[model samples]
Target: MAKEFTDEDDALLAELGVEVETKKEAARTPREERIIAGFEEIQRFVTEHGRPPQHGEDRDIFERLYSVRLDRLRAQPDCLALLQPFDHQGILADAILVPGPDEDISDEELLSQLGVDDIAQNDITELRHVRSTADKRAAEEIANRERCEDFDSFKPLFNAVQKDIDSGVRITRPIRKEAGFLKTDIRSGEFFILGGQVAYVAEVSDFFKAPNGESDARLRVIYSNGTESNLLLRSLQRALYKDETSRRVSEPSAGPLFTGENEDNDLASGTIYVLRSKSDNPIVTAHRDLIHKIGVTGGDVAKRIANAKLDPTFLLADVEVIATYKLFNICRTKLEKIIHRVFDPARLDIQIEDRFGNPVIPREWFLVPLFVINEAVEKIKDSTIIGYMYDPATSRLMRTKDWA
Candidate 1:
C-alpha cells in the first residue's frame, strides 16, 4: 500500500523547491500484464510480417514459436477475452494452420515447434507435454481406424474398383481446396483415396447438432487395406483437405467425362493410360518418344503390368507406367475402342515370344509420340476425339475432313 501524501507534506516539498509528480493508473494485474506483453510481441511480429507466424520445419524458430503462442492464446478463453481490447492485429479469429508432421523433429525441436521455449513454473503460456496438431490429427485418424472384421464383404467392392480403374471404368481426381466438398458431398457406397488407401463410405448417420451448434454426422468408412474408421463426417473432410494427393474415386460414367455433371446412377469410370515399353528392341530404343501403349483400364496400373514380363502384349518384358488420365462415366470397352482406333495408324510392328516360347502378336503398344497421346486424351474428355485422327507424318491429330 502507498502512503497518502498530506497537504503538509506537499507544502514542505514546495518550501524545499521540490515538485511532486502525478502517478498514472496501474489497473492491470501482473498476470494480465505478462499476458499482454507476450501478445504484444506477437502483434509486433504480425505488424512486421503482414501475417501471423506459421508452424513448419523450414520456418525460423521465432516465427514457429509465435505461431504456437498465438494458437495457445486463442485457445484459452480468458486470455482471448482479456486481450480482446488490445487485439489490434485481429488474430484471434484467423484460420491459422497447425504444425506439419514432426516425427523427424527432435524433442528439443518439437518443444520449439509447439512454442514452449520456457518450462519454468512461472511461465503461464508455456506449453509442455502437448502434442503437435499434425501428430494429434494423425493419431486421431489411426485411432479411429480399427480391424474391419466384415472386410470380407467389402473385398469384392475394392477389387471391382481396382478393376474399374484398370479398365477405365472409373477415375480418380485429386481433392484440391478449390474443389473441396461438404458433408453432403460424401455419399454412401462412394469411394475415396485417403493416405494412399481406398476408402469407402459404407454408412452415414443422420445429421445432429454439434456442441459448437454446427451440423455433423458419424461415418462408417472402410479402407482398401481391410481397415475401417468410425470417424465424424467433418473429421473425414478435414483429413481429405489436409492430404495433398487425396482423391475421390468417381462413379463410372460411360458418357462424356467433362460435361461437369453426372447422375448419381451414372456409375461409369475410366482411365486414359500412357505407358512406355521396357523392350530391348532396336526400334523401341531408337524412337522411345514415338513408342507407347495407350489403353483403358478400370483397375490398378501396376497390377495390370505385373505379368508384363511374360506377356507378348507388353513386348515380353516389364514396362513402366508413364502417365494416366483418370476420367469418369466412360465405358471401359468403349474407351478401349476409341483410343485404339485413334492411334491405329501408328501401330508398332513388333512380335515376341511368351514365357512358353509361343510366337505372339502384341496389341495396345503403338508407334505414336506421347504428346500426341495426351492431346488425344484431352480431345476425348471434350467429346471431340471422334473427329480427329493421328497424323504420323506431322505427329499431330488431324481432322478427317482436313486430312490432305
Candidate 2:
C-alpha cells in the first residue's frame, strides 16, 4: 500500500529543483554483513582501548582472538577492499601497510570467536557425556599446550648440542621406523636433529590415552636459538617423519667432561703441557711474560723436556714446565691441533736460532696469558670452545658470529 503524493509533495520537490520518485536501499549479502560486523567490532575495540589489540596469553582471551582476526583481515586484500567504505578509522590503509603472522591463529580462539559457549546447566547424564566427548575431541585437536616459562634454562643444552654436532662429537642417524621414536621411545634429556636444528626433549608429561586409544604425551621441545614449543609427542613425531633431514643424535662427542665426570677414560691418556722457554735471548726476555710454548705429551713432561736444549722444536734451550693438564680418551695429536687452532691468532712471530744456527720460527708458541690457555682448555672439555675465538686485542675468548 503506497501513499499518494499530494500537491504539498510536488511543491517541496519543485522548491528543491528535483523530480519525485521512490528510492530503495541496496541489499548486502550475508557474507558481506558478517565481514562488516567483524570489522565494526574490531573498530569498537580500538575506539574503547585507544589502541589495537595485540597477541600473547597475557592479554584477555577475547583481545587475543580479536588480534588474530585483525591479522587475518589485514592479510586478505579482497576483504580489505570490501570493507574500505566502513573503515572510518583508516584500518584498511594501516593494515595494508603492516605485515604479521595472520595465519598463526589457534583453532581454540577461532571456535571461541564463533560463539561456542560453555555448558553450565547440563541436567541430563547423556548430554553431559556428549559434551565430554566433544571436549575430548577439542583437546586432542588443540594439543593442550601452554607457554614454557622456563625456556631460558634449556637454551644452553641446545647450544651445546649444536657445538657438539659442529665438532663431530655428536652424529645424527636416520630416524628409522623400528627405532620406537614414534611410540613409547621418546624420553626426556634425549636430543634429535630435526629441521636442520638441534631439538632437545627438555621435559615430557605423563602418558595419556587419546580418543583413538593411542598413547600421547605433552613434550617441551627446546630448539636451537633458545626458543621452545610445548607440542604433543605425536605432533613432534609427525614433524620428524615429514622432515627428510631429521635424525636422532648419538652419544655426545666432546668426551666425559660434558657428562660431569672427574675420571678419564680407559685409553692411554695424554697431558697438555705448557712450556716456558729458559732462553737468555733478548727477544725472549722482552716477551717472556706473553710467550709460551703449548704442546701435548703422551709420556712424562720431564722426560719430554730432557733434551730441549738439543732440540730445535724447543727453541734450542732448556724449558720449564709451567702447566700440565691430564686428558684421557683423547688423541694427543688432535688435542695439540685444538690448542694451536684456538691460539692461532696470538702465535708468536719471532725467529729463533736452532742448534745449527739456522733462524727458524716456532709456530706452536703463542703470545697469550696462562689463564687464557686454561680457559680455552675448559671450553674444549665442555665442547663449547668452537663457539668462541681468541681475541688478541682483548686477550680473552669472545663469542664468534658464526657460532652464535
Candidate 3:
C-alpha cells in the first residue's frame, strides 16, 4: 500500500534543506586514484620517518623508490593539486619541478626514474609458478659481495683524491650520461665523485649478460674516507642515475704537471726545494726537524742559495738544501703557491729582522716533517693532492670536511 504525503511532511523536509531527487556520489578516475594513493604512501613515510625519504644505496630500497616516486609526483601539477589536501607535512610546497612531457619518457627510463629495474607481475597466478633459472641468476647477481680485505693498500689513493679535490684539479658536476661516467664507461683506475665522496673504480670484473639481457659486472669501489665496497656495476650506475646530488668528478686537469716537455716557453721544468736554515740562533738550533723553508726554484738551487745569508727571504742565514723533487713543466710561482697552501696549517710563525732593521714575517716556512712533504709531492704528481691537511700529531694526511 502507498502512503500519501502531506504538505506538513514536505514542509518539514524543505526546512531540513534536503533535495527531493536522489544524488549519487561521483567516482574518481583511475589516474586520479593512483595519484592519490601514491601521495598518501609518501605522506605515511614522512609521518613514520619524521622526514622525507632520501635517495642513496645506504637508504632502504623501498625508501629510495618512494623518494623517486615522490619527485615524479611533485613534477606533475595535477598530482600536486590532488595531493594538496592530504599533504599535512607540506612536502609538496617545496617540491622541485622537473620539466618534461610524459610522452618523452620510455618505459625503461620511467622505471629507472622510479629507482627500480622492473616491476612484479600484477597477476597472482603468474607469481605462484616455479621460478626460472634466469630469475635465480638475477637474484644471485644482486646479492651483496664479499668485503675488500686489501683496503689499506688503497688508502694513499684515497688521500690523493682528497688532495685533488682540495686543489680544484677535480670538481663535482651534475651527474649526467653526457659527462662520460656511465656504467659502460666503468673501468679499472677510474675515479668519480659519488654520494659526496670520492669513489674509485679500483677493479672491475668481466661483463656478463644478465637475465634481462643487460650487461653487468662486479666492482671494487674504494671511497675517500678509507672505506671500500664490492658492489655490482649496475647497482652503482642505478645509484648515480637516480641521485640528483650525485656528482661526476671532472677529469684531472692535464696541464704541465703530467707532461715532460714544456708547452709554454715561459714555463720551466723546476724543482720544489726544501731547505734547512743554518742559523746560529739558539731557537733554530733547538728545532731542526721543526724548522724548514719550502720553496720552488727555477734556477740552480746551489746558486740560488749562494748568498742566502744576506737575503731576508732566507731569514738572513745560510741554508742547506735538504730535499729537491724535480717538477716537470710547471710554473714555479704556481707550484710554490700550491706547496704553501698544502702546508698552511703548519706554517712557521716566526718574526725576523730584515736588512732594513724592520721586523719581517716570512710566509714560506712550515714546521712539518720532511717525509710528509715528500708524500704531498707524490700525491701532486698523481694529481690527487687537493683536500688533505697535514696533521703533525698523526703524521698522516687527513681529508678536510669541506673541500669547496
The digit string of per-residue lDDT tens for model 1 on 274-388 reads: 8887778887899777789888778877788899877777887778888987756556787788788888888888777777878887888888877778777665654446546
Judging by TM-score against the true structure, name the best candidate: 2
TM-score of 3: 0.41
Off by over 4 Å in 3: 1-251, 254-267, 402-404
CA lDDT for candidate 2: 0.70
Candidate 3 lDDT, 1-404, residue by residue in tens: 96666778778888999655545898989777866776787789899767787776544555665677777777777777878888878998877786645432232353466444544564212322333556444433433333447768887877876687689666555666553344654567867766576788888888888888987888888776556677789878766765567765544663225333344554456778999998876767788777889988778889999999998788899998898877665677876877787788888887889888999888888888888887787556544555567776676665563232
Which model scores highest in lDDT? 1
User: Model 1, 350: alpha-carbon shift in Å?
Assistant: 1.0
The segments of candidate 1 whose C-alpha lies over 4 angstroms from its true place after superposition are 1-255, 258-268
Considering summed lDDT, which 10 consecutive residues are worst modelled in model 1?
A: 98-107
Estimate the Cα RMSD of every predicted model relative to the unseen true structure. 17.6, 17.6, 18.5
In candidate 1, residue 215 scores what lDDT? 80
